[model samples]
Target: MAHTKASNTPSPRTIIPTPVNSTADFAAQQRNMSADNASQGSGVKLKKEIGLLDGVAIIVGVIVGAGIFVSPKGVLLYSGSIGQSLIVWILCGILSMVGALCYAELGTMIPKSGGDYAYINVAFGPLPAFLYLWVALLVIIPTGNAITALTFAQYLLQPFWPSCDAPVEAVQLLAAALTSLLTVINCYNVRWVTRVTDVFTGTKIFALLVIVAVGIWYLCAGHTDHWNEPMRGTFTAPGLIALAFYNGLFSYAGWNYLNFVTEELKDPYRNLPRAICISMPVVTLIYVITNVAYFTVLTPEEILSSDAVAVTFGDKMLGFMSWLMPFFVACSTFGSLNGSIFASSRLFFVGARNGHLPAAISLINVHCLTPVPSLIFLCVITLILLFIKDVYTLINYVSYVEALFTTLSVSGLLWLRHTQPKTERPIRVSLALPIIFLITCLFLVISSVFQSPIEVGIGTAIIISGIPVYYLTIHRPVEWLRNLSQSFNLWCSKFFICMPNQEKFD
Candidate 1:
């Protein structure tokens, strides 16, 4: 006979004496234990190996992607002068800073990953949060990554191609490969991802500084004709300025990507806000100086006429060194793609953990300690999007929805404050911050509605498409579907060698 402990913990029997009958029996027992853990609602969790500099890298890398190089023309097109262009850049920076402050407070209070998804889930409810996730899954995050990768491919391949327009097949194939590369990188340990981001972030910053330095040299040597005519073709129409600001906002889009990985950041309460505070202002200054540099080297007419502003600026200013611009743009866009995969995968992981998505996506590789399933899922979705032509048109259809959800997210700050007054806040801003950001977001959405009603309608319809999904999953989930989801999740865990652990949410 064998004896067993008499404690409260459950046991297989009153008297436990049997050993494993075979290795197969041991493997079966392990699988059963994992399945039980999964049924108990436990999941894999993220490790916090990131720091302040890592956070800043994510923000700067994602925010500075290819946009600053190309968008000068768009800004100058609408602003009609260097002064107005600079103003738009600075104002968008301030708006981003205020928005970051609000997010910092929320990130600390909740102290979770998922960024806006976590904040909105707590402040509003699951329905609205699910809707946000639906759009993110189908549109916002994937399209954003696809656009960045396509841009990267376009710039990287432009040198070899004879025409100004890159060959469409080459661009698409290379973009897909780029996405696959970054996805594989992120599926490993977190440090690998941040390390890549930091190095590329440094590279892009150095490239920008080179441009700024050359511009300063030109200005010092008296290339000042454009400086004298700062407001010549100014279009101060409400619609035009709104549109200009809208474009500027797109360039400033990735400031909040850092917040998405809050769980992975060391000392997040202090570092999250500090990273945002540092990166936003620095990027703002870079944008202003870089635009000034562009205008210093290229006249407004040349700037407008050129298809690629930074390339033109390089050709005009850098002389023999003009060959470096395309490489720099490619690096910048590659970093953005890597950082986007890093951040957006976390959103999917968190959403999956919370039952908003299939639990398989929440799996973390035991050896790698990364969200393998989520990363792979995002890779497939983004790769599918890579096949779609006209990335800008696809992005435009969802821009309104992106702005609307961001407004809803920032508004969560106010809603949470009123509802959860006692929640601890490590970096609270004045009420005016979120209030002001929400107003700006609302103006953008409303103005877009008036300006592009049809596109806005399409975006709204895409979001509304999630309702039936919501009803099927949350409101009226089927037993067979749940069983199938659980079985699939178990299979993935076993295949990936995942070790199930209890996930914590604040």
Candidate 2:
């Protein structure tokens, strides 16, 4: 036994094998491994299935809302010419199309959800991404829904109770109730929400078509004299073009909403690009034709002075049926709110899933497969904002921020082009398109800032305040301070925070 314990380790040895058999077995094993990896990758790539029609429906549902219903009066007031205002709409549509195209490339490249937040993060990193998400949750989405809800309640109540002396509180409560109800519907089932939205979107489009058809018919009958009246402002002039562009920009607000649901959209690479390209031109045509109809029936002065622009146009041609205008407006607003609720909640969900937001927001309702917590949180905030008497103030404040963020998001396309050159981009922008998009966005941002310097300043303050909160929530004390310092410097250099060289917290 002692002698046998001499070697605990064994000597190396080689054994011969059938070379052909071993080679065949090795090749078979490799093929099996490759097949397994492919299957696993496909599983990871799976996403919610939505088609091009759904994408188009979502875009139209969100875009054709209170803007068209309420903004015509404001644009008429600004431009003082129906024809010139229509031109503005056209210009905005074109600019929006350019932006949408840029986003399409980004959306296809990333093919993730979360809309602007995703694009911004991929290009600039997390801080700027979180800032946009913070602003969107606190300001843009809530305020927008509140404004629409209030408008919806106002018009719906106005027609039914024209002579009823209701308290302001009653109207506010009604608006909040309507907003809450729609929120519930949307939070329950995606399919149900989409179906409701489709109906509302279709109705709104049909109503607009009817108005245009009737107005044109009346003009052909020589019932109106405003068709040949000179435009309110000179064509192609800077002032006129600027005014028109603003109007068009308002109409183009939701053109990029489809990008928000990239994960839910089936075949996003094909559907998203097609949906945006198709929807913008169609909406532009609708706006131009509708404005032409309006001008054919009423003078620029009349449109400018009218409190309810669509109703006035309807009244001139449709008489008693004009009351339907408010109802249609309500439907349009409801659809818009639903679309926003659906898209914006996904922003929070994605942010949370990626650790940018709290875990609570990312919690999915297993039963409904919807982000119920986020949806309910948004509803509460919107309900509170519904009490604000004036919609214009909210728009003035939120629109500026939205335009700024949108500009930043579009500018991200340039960064991605350099950083992720080999990344899969199912959609591609032309060489000059990004340049044109950037220029247009800059103009819009400048115009918005000049138009509402005070509101823009307030918005800036609100957005910047998020940095501290973000640190508090996500980082340890010392790390938080360091991150804040770094973020301040980064934002100063990139976003023109307070000074050109020195980064200040304020």
Candidate 3:
């Protein structure tokens, strides 16, 4: 029975009673049950229901989010010309594909949840992994959810605010509600999550196709002027181009996260790679076509001036159907929230399972077959973020950190080839894939740092701050920390109602 490893179940090879004493004891006790170990009878497992299509939906659903609708303006602002903007989008697609292929290799190799956390833990060590986890929990997941939720709220309520400037408080409230709704939805089961993802993915894709179709029809009907002066209004500075890449890359962010739930995917070794290969190209083509549709109607000035580029395009092109654009954009953002909540919860579950976080965070609802505790935690954090003023500004801080960790995670391909060459790699990528992705990631990080040193410093400091916390909880394992974890687990079990109580790892 070659199954995915469960977060709560220890490997049968090592039996241990509850309440382990020291950090070393806990670390040694928590087995890294890879695919090989599971075949030897590790009852610990997650239900594998995600098929090829579901896996592809998760990738596509998360990647094609509010960024695509909003990022084009930033790209045009720096791209210096319409042609350069399109070129940047294409280059980003290529860059994302390279990174996705590299991760496909790593995902099959590890076949575990936690995405970057799993890869970094294996290649470098636990400390670096812990730092990544720290940033992920605190920044990456919450900020992303908040940003998407806000985007969703804006679009959903855009009709009321015809001027497109909705009240900040009203938007945050709706965003909070949206985050809570998705979190609750994800608490059901993997099947439900995938079903919702499939429907939403289809809806958004259909919407994009509608846009593409109409754009082509409109172009055929005489919207040739925008294409004629493609280079009319473009900006051409190095810093600006670099910033454009950042925006474009952000739109392509979620392509790597399908690996976060690898344990839940059916025949992960084969399906994971297939899903990545299929989703990235589809998303790229859709994105390119959608941009073409936008340029078909809106000029560079129109695009740069509008807060919601998609809505503006709709207003210009669609007769009475312009009203539908906000609804479609809301659907896209909501789907993105679903995907983010689903993936981020797995990181918390994996972090707790690996003994880097509170043991309570690992609780899974056996009946529901979901990481309930982790999902709730993410929802709560996202809700908190909704209250913060200028949450979108926080994106740059996490973006810098995201690029750094992604670079490190992709480099694992090179490291593991040297260190664990004999380890079964069902899908190995070319050496150049990781190299190219790393160079691209490094360039993004360096450019962003030069442009926004303060934000980069904040991100770096947050990662470094994890070092002492890591020492306190993981390295030293203080008695107070043990008590705190135990209390937290107890509180979570009691309050969350549905979350199952697993034996504490500590």
Clashes of each: 0, 3, 5
lDDT of 2 by residue, 112-156 (tens): 778899999888988899899889887788888887777777777
Q: Model 3, range 349-431, lDDT digits (tens) per residue?
A: 99888989987788665346578888888888888989988777777777788889998998777999998989998888888
lDDT at 390 for candidate 1?
Answer: 68
Tell me the tens digit of each residue's lDDT in model 1 across 155-242: 8998897466888889999999999998988987788999999999998998899899999999999879888978888888766787
Q: Give lDDT per model, in order.
A: 0.84, 0.72, 0.82
Q: What is the C-alpha RMSD of each candidate to the true structure, in Å?
A: 6.0, 14.3, 5.6
Pairs with backbone N, CA or C atoms under 3 Å apart (clashes), candidate 2: 50-266, 81-232, 88-244
Candidate 2: clashing residue pairs, number:
3
- TM-score computed on alpha carbons, candidate 3: 0.89
Ranking by lDDT: 1, 3, 2
Determine the backbone clash count of candidate 3.
5
Which residue pairs in model 1 clash with each other? none
Maximum-lDDT candidate:
1
